[model samples]
Target chain A: MKRNKKMIIAFITPALVTFLVMFVYPVIRTVIMSFFKVESLTASTSEWQFAGLDNYIGIWKTPIFRTSMINMGVIWLVGGVIVLSVSLLLAVILTSGVRFKSFFRAAIYLPNVISAVALAIMWIQYVFSKKYGMLTSFFRALGLDNLAKISWLDSDMKFWAMLIAFCFGAVGYYMLIFLSGIEQIPQDLFEAATIDGANKMGQFAHITLPLLKGVFKTNLTFWSINTMMFFVWSKMFSPVETEASTISPVVYMYNIVFGTKGVTQRDAGRGAAIGVTMALFVLIIFFIFNRVLKDDDLEY
Target chain B: MKKKVISAVLCTTMAVAMLAGCGSNGGAKSNSTSKATSAASSAAESTSAKSKSTEPAKAEGGKNLVYWSMWNETEPQAEVIKDAIEEYQTESGNTVTVEWKGRDISTIIQAALDAGETIDLFDEDYQRVGQQYASKCMDLEDMAKAADYETHSVEALPTALRGWAGSLKGIAYQPYTSGIFYNKAMFKEAGIEKEPATWTEFLDACKKLKDAGYAPLVQDDAYVLYSYGFQIARHLGQDGVVDLCKNGGWAESEGALAAAKEIQSLVESGYYSEYAPDAYPNNENEIGYENAAMIVNASWVPSEITNNTKCDIEWGMFNYPTVDGGKDPATVANVGAQAFAIPDNSKNGQAAFDLIMKITTGAFDQKMALDTQSIPADPTNEEWPEMIAGCKDAFNALTNVYDWNMGLNTDADLKTVIQDNLMKLFEGKMTAEEFIAAVDAASK
Candidate 1:
């Protein structure tokens, strides 16, 4: 037993060291940094002023930060619903013994392969442009002149327009995950359900969904993670400093740390505080998901 | 067999552990180096800048210098600089590699310097000397004094360009003066011979242009600030601007109201293009295409027009029209572009300084002025861009030249506030008083 214990310890040592160095150290440093007043990222620790949670309090007081949180919540909750629902629907259709599934999957996945900057430009210039845009022309062709005249890229509608574009690019990724989960269920269970006078809807409800609990949890976690780190789309859409409508916590943190939004000052401590808060939020969401969406490991 | 497998795993784990430890050590070393490098650079900058020691000129040898330029290859300014580099290489026999960083120069330079990378020279926004990379930049005051730079520069060196700790830092790579760029042909067609000298006459010209079926004044959302900046300059002056930035004093100020009211009137008069809300250079393009009569833009606007539109535009520049009964009626709002800054860690500081001096004072400056159709720093150089040639009287007699921000050394956020409120004012969403009140609230 002693020799076995020694072998187990030895086997785990490398990964343990990697984790402590890469993950544990940085996280601890960031948490510590959150308490200080950091004027510059490149400044020495001696230059750092100990503010005792002042940085956290300061971010809380900032109206823009609050606005960012509300924006992020909308993206996470509203975008989450649309993405999951549409992806599930697409997955069900694709896996229902549909023909030409391969072609359809590849076509849907095309947007994911493009860079965020290019995709944003295409949406803004080609789709949402005030003149000669796809949406405008389509609306006009359908004789919906009022709808066609609406400026999609205007300040009032920009947030929803960008969100729709982001969802268009994101739906395909989650759909693939759902399709894989559906395919993993035992064929015999569905056959038996059909044999017992169960219709397609009943089979899906009894067998398919229950089995996809693990996949749903995974998809939810990923969606939350993506929502938390929502910077690129916001950045591409705004191009300059983010607007109130599109600002996210990650984008806000980036602006604070880099002073890239023409704010004229860097506050590394405030940025670290934002990071810690975001991490905490994500952790809370993950735990809630795990608790609410319980699943057992089942074999085919 | 189990013993052998366990032993093999143990060996592999130990090796991996050792490798991880080594990697961590390497990372720590790099971080320490970055810190040390930045601190050393700051120290060097202070010493060189304060003492103003005449560092001896070195022999033009095989040493190569690296230059990171903000201007892309396509810009006329970039073309002029490239030609100068080649000329310098042949004449002085010194080697230099130029990296065209364009709009990404800010982030790229910041990251590179943070990583302890060597950057001998770079062109960055003049405000950066005061705001962003102050410590990393070498103070060129002593060099400027030794070179008698002020006399040769286009405008008298303003103290606002000082570094954060109050030292003359970078020299202007190029300077841009903003005003009305109007189509001379369009003006003739409208039966207006002379450019407007006052706000009232300016409006009259706009009316005439409108009567002639031309969009009188075109603007875009991107640079709407320029439209009101000239009027703001006349009201605030340099000192008033500084005071407004430091204290909450903008609400209902005569200058602020006049400027705001002026823009609101122009916007309400239907002088602006229909596509003014479109992205920049689109509405500005109307003047080049002869769809619009005039635009309030920098000296570089014509270059943009040429590049983006196909029309053979007969462009002429005028000083931003004076406001009748304003504090400084003849104020010219001049904006300086990125300047050449040497890194404190540069291995060849003298060489970098020499190259910059050569570019700014020598024939290269003249070439740049001719090619870009903009003013050069050296006013006595006699080589004037054709468009600016028409406005020589205004350029010479200009008593005040302020940045579009009115030279208010405030937070960039305050500038954004001004811009946003100004946009709101133009859009008819807010009154001039409300706009000023908003700025006042933001300042507080």
Candidate 2:
């Protein structure tokens, strides 16, 4: 027993030290700095104190923060559902004893290997350009040049366009995850279903999906987290002076803390308040989501 | 009793060791090399300079810096900066390790800023300058007033550039200047004789090009739209309007409204080539594939848009298409210079500052043009591509500053209002009048 205790201590020490130094220290520092107003960049060195929960209360009243929360939640739902559903469907289709399965698998998984910046550029340049985009050129070749030069990222369809690019780039990884889950299923169950005269569709609905519940839960949870971290993508995607779309909770927190291109005093307390609020909200959201989505346990 | 004894002993040893570690060693030849460079650069500026910035790094010696850049718009210039650093390291063996944050300074830059932490040196966006001033996050005056002040000559920067950096509160880097970049071949194909000198002719030319199966313009809607609106605002508010807009909500009221109307008309008229919203192009694209004959972009686009893409573009530039009877023909040509600042908490401040001064103010300009093929800051460089340098007068005629609110001017509520309601206008969810009302409501 004593030896086990020592072993556990040895294993846990590094992580514990890391958490205290990296995570705990920063959080405490940020929470404390969330108060006090910046006079000028170099003039202040003092760690300013709190002026009540003004930082926390103030963020709630700001429309930007509110909109970000709404948009982040929506992106989580929409991006998660679309990527998961489509990729899972593709994984199953390729795995259903089909010809050229390996080729199809490689093609499906190709995009995830490419960097997001590179993928984003390719989508803009060769794929969507009304002039040179293969898509636009095909239309022009058919003499429907009016459709050429259409701006995909304009206000009319900017969000959808961004969503499409993000989903398309991300589907490959999700497909592989779903494929692994599909592979782990017992072949005997499908055979049993066949003997009972259940069609392919019936076998899929009755056995495949129900049995893949654990994977789906894991996939959706991760997807939600990824979508929620949208700041960098949103800023990159927006035109100057226009608003950003990928402003996740993290982005909003960042903007509040560091300030933005052309506005406001640094409110560290408010930024911390936003961070605290987000963490708590994320927890609440996960709880509500699991409660709503959790079905009966599926035996292996 | 045993746990207490161990804890007490470990804490004392570790704490003492950490304190010692933070204090960098002074006994190195590399430190002497850095000191020598600082001395040589100082001698170049003046003989009688008394700035104490000549001192070696004081906070802690031989500090490690984690620097990130968004994305370097030009690969050649990126190469030049990289080579220069490598050269510096070879010459002095004092290295500041770099990590690219992103292509456009948005990725790691945003993360760093949001983290509310001190960074050693970074290519921060010009827009962040205003916020830094307001939030007291940056110190331009201090950055410009360093010890070797004479040699680096930061104080000698163009007033217009300095003013744009939000100099009063924080130090904002001077940004790229916006100009009109057009396809020369497209002009000939449309049978237009010369660059438009008046707004009527500009629109007529665009209309003709539209009819000739070419997009007259393309909207990136990703980075330059609101800036485009700011440029247009200069034209709409003629006759001392720049001053008027800065002093009051006259810009947001009448100025932003007019610009909004112009954007709507552009959308309705079908003169634009659109890219996807998420696209941040650091390289060649189909637009330069001769899609739209022209684009309104900053100084760096010359490097970013050419050489890589296989477009045989014969490019030419014009001033902001002449505004009607405008007092000043100059519309705002955005100047977004990313400034490198030393954080108050940085231990490597002196070394980083010395390096920054050497890199930005010296061979970096020539290196930039040669490496990236972009326009050079130093006018003396003969290597500049004719397309960019030949029409210098026309380009210089464009305004260089944003010329809006500063000094307690906060963009928080204003930016929020615009982001929310502006989308509706772009999405066909709101009209020009509605946008006007939205601005008015926001201002009040």
Candidate 3:
């Protein structure tokens, strides 16, 4: 027993110390920073002025920040629905003894393997390009001149365009998760269902979905976290400056913290406050998910 | 017991390795600093030995200058700088160690400065160096006097730096001005005899170009705010525009309304191209493709267009034309420059300043301007690149330099709102009244 304990301690010390230094320390510092008026990120604690909830209150009053929050909310809710449904649908189709399943899976997941920056550029420069864009060419080919004329990168359509591109890349990962969940449910249960007069749709609705509640919850949690850190796509869409249509909470936080072109003031305190807000949002969503999707004691 | 002993040994090794890694980094930094010092001393001795008889005054060898540049190694600017550094080392017996931080220097520079990093010299946007790092920068007034920089360099730049930071904060290099960079071939094709000097003449020029079956003006979405800012600045100078942005007087400012009405008329008259507010580089490329005649952009646009598309555009530039009853004259322009600064914490400030002078003046300045297709910093170097030769008169004639977006970008909160509405105005989606009202409400 002594030997085992020694071995465990010896193996875990490095990881524990790293975790404390790298992750825990920064988290604690950021949390404390949220309550202080820190102009520069490198400003010493001695220079920090205790602003209490001022940063939080001030950020909420900022119109651009408010716009960013609204944009994030829309991306989360709308993007979540589209991504989950499409990924789930693809998961079902792929796992239903489909042809060349590996090839199809690889094809769908290829974008996820590519860098988000490169992927975003491909979408912006080619897919959503005003002139000679894929969608414009497609629409024109089909004699949809009105649709062809629509500028997908314009302020009105940019958000949706970004969302669609983001969701397209995200579906593959969630689809894999759903695929695993579907594969895990015993073949005997499905065979019995088929024998009982439960058709494919009925089987999916009753057995597959009910059993996949845990996976759905997991995917939802992941989606919520990803949406909270929604930065790259938004940044890529508005490369030069943060646009109202594409600005997210993280992007807003980055701008205020690191100082973008137009942002004269760099308040790391407000950036920390935004970080804390996002963390709270993710935590609340996690709590809600846990409560709503309670995993039952089901015999596999 | 054996497994535990092995694991204990492994853990101890890991901890020791981590500590050693950190120690090595510290050691490396210390080593570099000492190396620089030793190199300076050795060079001093050698110079004294070699030049003692011929030039006793030049016997004191050069100091090592640590320069953190904003350009990557592959960039044209960096190549020119590298050549200059080599020449400087050969001529003055100075050692310059340059770290190519690229654009990320702006973000990391403050932190590095705060950390008391041994950065002898650095360069960034003049406004950023002047305003953001004002207290940290060494006032170059005495150094400029010693070097006779006032007589050698462009007067407007140093004057602009003084205005920016209330002192001579930085030495300007690679200076550029934002104005109407136009296709001269298109101008000739449209029967335009001369560049427009006033708003009415500019509009007439636009009409003729449009009548000649060419798009008169096209602006990228990224530069729409800048374009609008130039128009606003023409009406209300840079300070007035900044005041309007800071305060909630946009709806009340007659200048703001006039500027908006001018842009509105441009949109209404089809003076702007069909893709006026297209994404960056797209609308700029329209000028390169000879589809558009003019774009209100920086003097670097021709070079950028040429580099990107390899299209030969007969580029000509003119300052933003004077608006009717405008406070600012046609002499005022939005001029910006890259500048070198010696940080207050720098140990070898004089050495850094000397290196900066070497890079930014005389033959090197002309060389940099030609190689990089940038405007020469040294006034004495009048052999401007043919691509941007037309900018010389406009640049030299500038009585005032405006801030980016005419200081409309001063307020972070209103920046996006103002830009969005400006785009809407150019796209004919919103009227001038709506723009003013919208921006005013947002400011409040």
Candidate 4:
């Protein structure tokens, strides 16, 4: 037992050290920093003193702060459901001995290989172009001359349509993750269900889904974290400057420090505060989700 | 015990990583300075004292020189700098490496100053760093005081050029000029006789184009909105946005609001679309050239816009139409390109300034203009490209130049107040009275 404990400590030490440095230290600094008024980052003689909860209040009072939460929520629910449903459907279809199963999986995972910036450029210039865009000319070739000038960006249904585009580009990769998870279930389970006179639908609901609960939970946590950070894309090309468009709270923090040409390049203290808040939000969501779902973890 | 030990380790790691950033940048600075000091005592001792050109001058005892500019020193303009870099290298056996950071020179300079980062030379487009001039970033007067200063600093460029550097706070690296452009083919098809000179003529021509099913003025709301203060100077009757900045006022005068109303008319006229001001960088405006008749763009606009769009449309620039009372009725100067000072902590000021002149006035100007259609900053380049060279007549007329948002000293507390609410003027969110009050409210 003593030897085993030593082995465990040795194995965990590297990861523990990395986590402390990468995650916990920032949170500690942020908690300490949340107590002060920010000044220019380079004030030599000036000091960052304690100010206790003021930064928190300042963030809470800002209208954009609340709106960011709503936007995150929207991305969460929408991305989660669509991702789950499509991924499960693909998983089911793939398990049925599809002719080009390997090829299909690779094709869907293509988006994962492309960089975000390249994907953004491809979508903006070729896919969603407004006046004289590539999509327009394509439509015109098909006899819809006026459609060549159609701008999806300026339409009243902007967010709705953009949501669909996001889903299409993103679903394939996550679906592959589900496909791998789905493939792991034993063949005997399905055979047993069929022998028991359970129809395909009944087997899918009773056996397939229950056994796949672990995979679903894993993907849920995985995607929730992914969607939470979707602001990375939102800041790059959304049309409006609403909290939904130009900034997420983290990106907003970036602008606060780096955007202006002033003496304050970045406020380390305030950045820490923002980081802590973000971590807290993510943790809260994780707990709330776990509590609501009871996170059924099953063993074979 | 596991949690405690884990927490301690986590805290230590976090402290180190964050400090790692502080360490790299800060350590670099200290390491350079100490090396520079050691070099200052003996030329032989200094060459190997530092590893990079982080110290102010004398990296390997002048084996290297660094020039930092707000943007890339690219072709059509970088040639002179490249030649000068060669000359500089041959003369001293020192290679001048140019750091071409695009945009955000102001913040870079400030950070350098704070860190005492040695910069050799720094310059940026005036509009981007104009706000820096409103505060003290660096002083040209002091540069003139430097022992290595040249005869070029003695006489200075032309007054307008000098003004480019002279908010009395920061110095301009070079002077820039502006002009107007129109589609020559569009005018001929519309059969509107000539380019408009007066406001009525301008409006009339616009109406005719509108009637002809063309957007009269293709103002890009996606880019920073371009409105010339000089042409409207005749109407404002005051010193324009400048005088207002000095005395803490915004002109509610008949002229200023009239300009706003004119723009509002264009917006309300269903002839306009804008990317959200902050968000337009990637939006539909990149595809702007195919739809609109005329654009209020500087010389660089043609290449930048047409780079992606291969439209073979004939375009031309003319003087911005003016009211009878405006200063220099043909003037269109509000924002134009100019270089700005580097932070005082520059390590290689000589090499940087040497590069600036080469890029701006030297042979690079000719090469850049010919290749890229970028207008020359020298104001005397007669060997011109046909389309761009022809712009001199229009370029010379710019005066009464002012943009509240363009200068370095923009009152920041009021910037959002002005920009957010002022955009509403284009959105027709306020009356002219409200517009003036809204913008002015920021300064106060």
Highest-DockQ candidate: 3
The TM-score of candidate 1 is 0.82
Residue pairs of candidate 3 with colliding backbone atoms:
none
For residues B1-444, what per-residue lDDT tens digits would candidate 3 score against the true structure? 686677778889988886676551211111123344444565565543222111112224456678888898788888788877776565555667788888888888888777778889899888888777777789989777767788777788888789868999899999888789898988999999989999999999999999999999988778878888899989988889888888778878999999999999999999988877787777788887888899898888899999877998778999899989999998988878899999899877766777788789877888999998999998888899999999988898888788777888888778889877877888788999999999999999
Question: How far does residue A55 in candidate 4 sit from its true spot (Å)?
Answer: 3.4
lDDT of 1: 0.74
Model 4 lDDT per residue over B1-444, tens place: 796588667756865665575453321111112233344345534443221211123333344545555554554344444554554444333455566665545456555656666555556545444443323354545433342233322122224334544542333433434445666777777778887778778777777776777666643223322342333344553255445545565655555566666666666765443432223433223333444566555565555555556655555667667775654455645444555455555555544444444454435555645665766554445565655554566665555554423331233333333434445554455665777776666455
Worst 10 residues of 2 chain A by lDDT: A36-45
Best-first order by DockQ: 3, 1, 2, 4
Whose lDDT is higher: candidate 1's or candidate 4's?
A: 1
Q: TM-scores for all candidates? A: 0.82, 0.72, 0.93, 0.72
Cα deviation at B22, candidate 2, in Å, is 14
Write down the DockQ of candidate 4. Answer: 0.10
Chain B vs. true chain B: TM-score per candidate? 0.79, 0.64, 0.90, 0.68
lDDT of all predictions: 0.74, 0.58, 0.84, 0.54
Between candidates 1 and 2, the one scoring higher on DockQ is: 1
lDDT of 4: 0.54
How many clashes does the backbone of model 3 have? Answer: 0
| Complex DockQ per candidate | 0.28, 0.25, 0.54, 0.10
TM-score of 3: 0.93
Task: Rank candidates by lDDT, best first.
Answer: 3, 1, 2, 4
Model 2 error, position B239 (Å)? 13
What's the best-to-worst order under TM-score? Answer: 3, 1, 4, 2
